[model samples]
Target: MPTTASMTRRLAIALTSVVAIFWFVALGLGVYVMQDEFTEIFDSGVQETAERLLIIVANNEARDASGRPVEAAVLAPALNSQYLTYQVRDSNGMVLYADGAQEPFAVPLSAGFSQTATHRIYTAATTDGTLFVQVADALDHRSEALMEGGTALLLPLLLLIPGSIAAIIFVVRGTLSPVAQLRDEIHTKDGGNLAPIDESALPKELRAIARSVNSLLARLKSALEAEREFTSNSAHELRTPIAGALAQTQRLLSEVPPAFHQRTAQIERALLHLGRLAEKLLQMSRAEAGIGISDERADLLPVLMVVVQDLERSPLGASRLNVKVEDGTALERSVRADAFAIVLRNLIENALIHSPPQSPVDVHIDINGIRVTNDSALIEPDVLVNLTKRFTRGPTEASGSGLGLAIVKRLVEQMHGQLLIASPARGMTQGFEVEIRL
Candidate 1:
């Protein structure tokens, strides 16, 4: 079977994916904005350095030309490596002085900012425009700063995404827990259990569903009760008339002429079959009424013994039944005595009727459950599957109402037990078996 997708998992995954995508988009936008800001700040620094250097270089050159002493501190070379490199050039574009520059920048000397592939350049000049100072900031330094800023913003997401996923799953599972509970409660409703769901604890959205389900269950329970009552009453009303009719037919068989005896016997047989069918209907009604479950536990061994003994007294059961009880076996269970007896009677009677003449019906009892087996041709798989259905029978000439297994199956389920029907019973090659586990 294919696996089903969970609502909680699907919701969590969708939510997490959306959150991650938006987070990535926001991070990209943030990085873009930060890059622009960094460029502006670097440009300002480059322009400021060019203007300052132009003042100092122009003042020193004027002092040198006037033969006046220039302040050494103002013209001192930078002791540390600077991010900005500069070249001082005269109007003819000849280099006068340079700081942190291996070679003059390959660009025109003009005032204002310009950019080359490698650097951001800003130029400043004296009042006469006789000299110019061009400041160059390496492009790689700005790129490195932007990369570090982006990394700082991105690293937290590694932890945040997984943590968010975990939190999302947790919240999704919690939010859907009520739905799971409602499903379980609805699943418990059946013929044997039609109890209404408690709507008090449910959310507003699901309370309407619970109320609708409860209404349906109420109608169903009423209909089933009416059906069971009619079957039970009709069966009870039929038993006396059927028995009387069978007795009268048997008397008529004795009184009738030899030529009429065959027809009278046929009538007797028909009445007998009708009586058995009525009894089965009664049993089915009781099973449908959910009489198998009991609050009080009882020793089921005595009930089992009584049913087997009663069946043993019958001519068909006499000398054709074998009973085996495991040592130290205990049948203390919560199933009602009458219901358990009906189940046992049906299974044993079914086995006895279907088995060939002189074939022994074996009944095995243990702590776990009970098993009934009988010698017969192996039942077909398709036919075996439908054996517990009402009026369904196998390919057999034996007389049966076909409600025995159906009744037993109903009672077993009401008792919260499992009934398994199998061909080639256990280790035997040609037999049928009914095993019940309670």
Candidate 2:
């Protein structure tokens, strides 16, 4: 398949070819028109020369072959135009009298003072009924004149064709310069770069093409990033399980008493890690698939309260995490969101996992949004940026599959809400916060 750039260039060239072909045909027609004009001039001049010769022959009192009178001149200056070469012919095809030449030219049959030769020939009867003819070399003159005229006509065209082609090349290349720039940018794109190309001021013909190419680049960039994250997450999440399985196998082989007991425990723990990995993979797939989450008018305060209550029922609930609910001074308490239960469950679960043990996880909820900030050191700045990225985990202080916050972010976005996290004093006090729209 032809690439977009190559296809566009070929189209441009084809258009130019069409124009050049029409122009060439037009030039040829012009040459033909000029040839006709030359022929007309030649014919008219020959006829006039023959007519003058007829008058000259009729006026003369000279006698011809049988005592009939015939007129003859030694090529008068007025008739010595060279193109109008004249000859006097008898009734037979014989050149009896000739001018402007020592030898006779072709004396074709000229009857009743009419044209016969390619050059115009006039024949007339003298007073004695003797035959006389006057003719000129009009065809020779027309041929020479046309050839001379064409040097001016065809020569310029010879130069024009190449110059026109050169101009088209320059114009097309200049017009497509933006596309060239876009191609170069695409060639140099990194897996993470998905930014759109700036194609403002491009001609309308190419604007659509540029937009389509940019869109394709954006999709490819997204796919590559998703693949990288998926691979990284798989390797990172499986590490623990693989290690546990290996340790159990070693213990079963080395230890003598109660080996089966410890081995079973290790295998169970490894199975648990595998189960979490499977869930995380499923969630990642859902996020990547862009499944539309149904929207509903959800009350922020009650939904968050239920989420906090559920988390309190979990192991972290025994740790006594502080969950607070705040509200905005707005008339509307309800906003469109995905399933309230799923949203709250992901947020609360993420908070419990990230918050330090014995440190209170503050689940601050409000009408506009909810902020789940916990007492913990913030992860590195880059890590915080990558928090919403699939398979990214929080600081090593917390044991997590790293997909909890990413799932929360995806869920919130699906609900048309935003998620933001910040930790001031390097996660010392203020901790990380996730603010979602109501």
Q: Per-residue lDDT tens digits of candidate 1, residues 58-172?
A: 8789899999987745544531235777888999988877777757778888789888899889999887989999988999999999999989988888888788889988998
lDDT by residue (tens digit), candidate 2, 1-438: 975657455756776678667867876787799888876676566666666666666555344435864534433654755566666666664666677554544443544334434554444445444546566555666667777776766676677656766777778787778777767766644332356667785667777877887888778867755765675576567666666775766666456467466766666566666766666665556554443243224345555566667677777665566765554533133232223455566666676676667667666555566666666665678877888776777666655677777767766665556777776523455476776764
User: Which residue pairs in candidate 1 have backbone atoms (N, alpha carbon, C) closer than 3 angstroms, thus clashing?
Assistant: none
Number of clashes in every candidate structure? 0, 3
Candidate 2 least-lDDT 10 residues: 329-338
lDDT score, candidate 1: 0.88
Model 2 scores a C-alpha lDDT of 0.62
